[model samples]
Target: EFYTQPVQSSVTQLGADIYTGDNCALNTGSGKREVVVPVKFQFEFATLPKVALNFDQIDCTDATNQTRIGVQPRNITTKGFDCVFYTWNENKVYSLRADYIPTAE
Candidate 1:
């Protein structure tokens, strides 16, 4: 399944508009699932921005399941950010949300 949502800018100066979602099946194969969603920013920032991945919820039903699941930002740029979702079990499904924010410095 695929999903996407537009990110509105609370600060008008930023003028942020981006689309983020997963591009893979709910049930993935045995290995790492690369989550690279496309981002559309109206304006540029003073420096390279940062990508944040937050796992709001996750469900995996298996008594003997010994799989580890996690999501992290692998790369970040003005265009978009590359996130990687990894899982050792092939039957796990995850729900994640991403955000792009300007750098502190």
Candidate 2:
């Protein structure tokens, strides 16, 4: 499986539009099945200008037994996170692939 238990994820922004996520699905269909689901960030009051992303575990379903997974942020042009994951029979697929890139403001 390419997902973790209790699938949930979040991405926090850092002044410079530093977006992020904890999951990315790719190449699991008739063609390239790259999917980047945007997640909301966890922000709190009185917090010192910082943000974080959290992903609740979820299956990264693919039409093929083999697949690639990770996270992608639009903030970083031409950048993404990717990883290969093998499938297990009779079980939901999931991957811990995630992407993150910090830029100077």
Q: Which tens-of-lDDT digit does each residue in 1-105 have in candidate 1? A: 999898644322232323224434434565555445455455655457665555554554334666566666565665545556555555455444544444423
Evaluated against the true structure, the overall lDDT of model 1 is 0.50
> What TM-score does each of the candidates earn?
0.52, 0.27
Off by over 4 Å in 1: 1-23, 41-43, 98-104
Report the Cα lDDT for candidate 2. Answer: 0.34
Q: Clashes per prediction? A: 0, 21
Cα deviation at 73, candidate 2, in Å, is 1.7
lDDT of 2 by residue, 1-105 (tens): 596688554433432222223332332324334444343333332322222233334455544565433333443222222222333333233434333322222
